[model samples]
Target: MTNRNIKAIKWFINTQLLGKWYNVAYATFKVTSKCNLKCTFCNPAYYSGTLEEGSTERLKKVIDNLRDSSVVVLSFEGGEPTTRPDILDLLGYAHDGSFYVMLTTNGYRLGDPSFLSKISERIDFLHYSIDEYHWNLKALDNLCKFREFGLKVNVQTVVTRYNINTLEDKVKKVRECGYKILLMPAVDYPDSKVKLEPDKEQFYQVLSYLKGKYGSTLNNSWGFIRALKGEFPKRLTSYAITIYPNGDLPYPDDINGEVIGNLSQNKLGELLNSYRAKELRRKMMENSARYEYLHLQTASFNSIKDLAEYAREMGKWAFTGKA
Candidate 1:
């Protein structure tokens, strides 16, 4: 088996078979918080360019820490990850490591052929954050174009109270292009007053309908769909963790919890096992009903069906470069 496959298998055995829920399987590294667009539903801190990005060397150290923690997947997110000057360097570094690297972008920088060409080889998947919120309605028109660069593209659409009905059309567009789309609800951050979160009943109904019609093209497990309806008890928070630009880990998650420690100062495995992390995990479990973050909620795969669905979607993407 390839090194990436071996790492994935090891992670699966550690987390799934051994029941080591704290062993992280995925890491979302926010490379920068300087986005070009001002989406109303997005967290201001994420796009305000206020967070100080660490130097490339420091970020590499953070990646090394995640690798040591046995994280199987590392997704580079941001205000806009492409906004960073050394993004290619970081992506290439992570790609060379054991983690399967992915980049999430708004596609603004992707218009530059040179930049697109450079990033395509350094990452396994390109998660395109497209929606009316990003002001990229016509972005779906160019989905197939990235295939020419040999980049596997996945659409990530924000399902808000205003845009829930339009999701079926987006799924259709993605399916036509032989791509998959992961739809998530717009979260109301503690710092923001705007309530863009969709109604639970309506959101679940719409997602269920889309999943039934579109199959793997929808890219959401039934468990995740059920979790959207306030069924939040089975959350797997530690399965995926988020890291800030300067290497701070928002233990459990950024939305409902506090920073446990800085990855730059401590190893990820050690930090996750610290007292603060344990206390926060207990608190998060006690108040799980109120948590609505998509990343954390989706990690709560309560049934075998969920795991099977995820495996099938990932298998197709890994082998065929399509989903």
Candidate 2:
């Protein structure tokens, strides 16, 4: 079996059998908060509260901690991860570790053959951000080119009132490129004057239409899509985790922006066992039944294939926009 499969199996075992819900299965490490483009919807383009880039040594230690726990996938993100001179070094380190390494980029630097040559082999997949705000529709044409390098590609589109009506065209482009797209609602930071978040009913209608017409190409699980519309309960602590550029762990992630502790200084395992972490986990368990994806009835997994089957079923429901 592949290392990725082994790690995923182990993570599933830990979370289901041992009750390690706080032990993250997926993590987004903001390598740096600095980005090259000034996208109107993204925070990195304007937010200045990010800490200085952590040294390569510091990030490696963080990766070690996550791998030793139950993290299966480690996604490297940034204002633009390609901007960092040591990004290849970081990707190489994670690739050598137990976790499957993925990179999220704006695709600005990916057009260069030499640049793609150096980093393509180090990552398992590329999460290309494409939308109207980024104004990089040209990148969509280059999706198949990255696949030629033997790398999986997934597009992340941030949905907003401005772009909701036009998503069908973008979905067609993704289908023509032979890639999957993960659609997400745009967040309106409390401090921002512009409110691009779509209307509640409109958001549901758009998501449902995309799911029904192009479910095969959409990447988000059905539970997640429904949870966004308040149809399903969201258990943030039960699933993914995000580590900020400064090594700080934010509760419910960036929404509240409350830092629990720095991973650079404290062990994540120990922190999760602490009072605050325990309280959050306790809350997660109490409300776990509300999350459809959990399938609390039979939490045990016989094999990785079983888990995949379950996810596939949930994904079908998500595509149908079924409650």
Candidate 3:
């Protein structure tokens, strides 16, 4: 059997039989915070902090730490991972077949055929961010080109008020191009002057329309789509964890809370099962209906001040139905 298949089997055993609830199914690591373009909907620095990046040696350590965990799929993200000089080396180090290694890119460096030729071999798939906000609408033309390079591709489009009206058309385009697309709502950071979130009714309408018309082409599960629309009845199973560039665990299993532990200083298992993590998980299990709190952490809030503000808003909306 292939190494990946073996890993998949092991993951199944660990999460199912062993009941390793903290076994992360998806892990996203930000390799760098430096980007070639500044986006309105997203401030790349908002998540990763300053423009500095993790070095090859540091990244290798992070990868090793992740390998020791129950991470089945690892996706390298960034301000733009392509901006790093040693990204190819990093990708090669993680592409040892233990886990599916994916890269999320802005596609600025993808225009060069030679670059793609080199990096394509190291990563399993490429998630290209193509949306109106990035000013890279032409990126749609390169979907087939990525397929030609033998690289599996998925388009990640951030939905906002500006593009809500045209999302159905974009879904059609993605389907026509024969690639899957994951639609995520635009997160209005606590500090941003402009809140780009689409109107709640409009957001729900778009997601419902896309979920119905393009279910096959959409990457989000029905539960996730509903959760996005604030319809959280049951606890959403969160298997995705994000590690910041500095080795801090933002939210293990996407539950918002304090940094569990720095991978550089601690083992993944120890941190995931730490008292703090267990408490967070317990709180989530007990009050899984309040998905808004769970989601605020996933939306890239960097400070407690902002998180608290949003939490108040969520409470207001949830209790009094007024925001």
TM-score of each: 0.95, 0.83, 0.82
lDDT of model 3 at residue 64?
Answer: 90
- Every model's Cα RMSD, please? 1.7, 5.6, 10.0
Task: In angstroms, give how far residue 2 of model 1 lies from its true place.
Answer: 2.6
Cα deviation of 308, candidate 2, in Å: 3.8
lDDT of 2 at 110: 83
Backbone clashes, each candidate: 0, 3, 0
**Backbone clash tally for model 2?**
3
Where does model 2 exceed 4 Å of error? 44-49, 233-237, 280-323
Residue-wise C-alpha lDDT for candidate 3, range 225-266, written one tens digit per residue: 555566543333455677777777765432345677777668
Worst 10 residues of 1 by lDDT: 294-303
How accurate locally is residue 282 in candidate 3, as Cα lDDT from 0 to 100?
74
Full-model lDDT, candidate 1? 0.83
Query: Would you give me the overall lDDT of model 3?
Result: 0.69
Candidate 3 clash pair list: none
Relative to the unseen true structure, what is the C-alpha lDDT of residue 319 in candidate 1, on a scale of 0 to 100? 85
lDDT of each: 0.83, 0.69, 0.69
Between candidates 1 and 2, name the one with more favorable lDDT. 1
Candidate 1 stretches greater than 4 Å from native: 231-237, 292-298
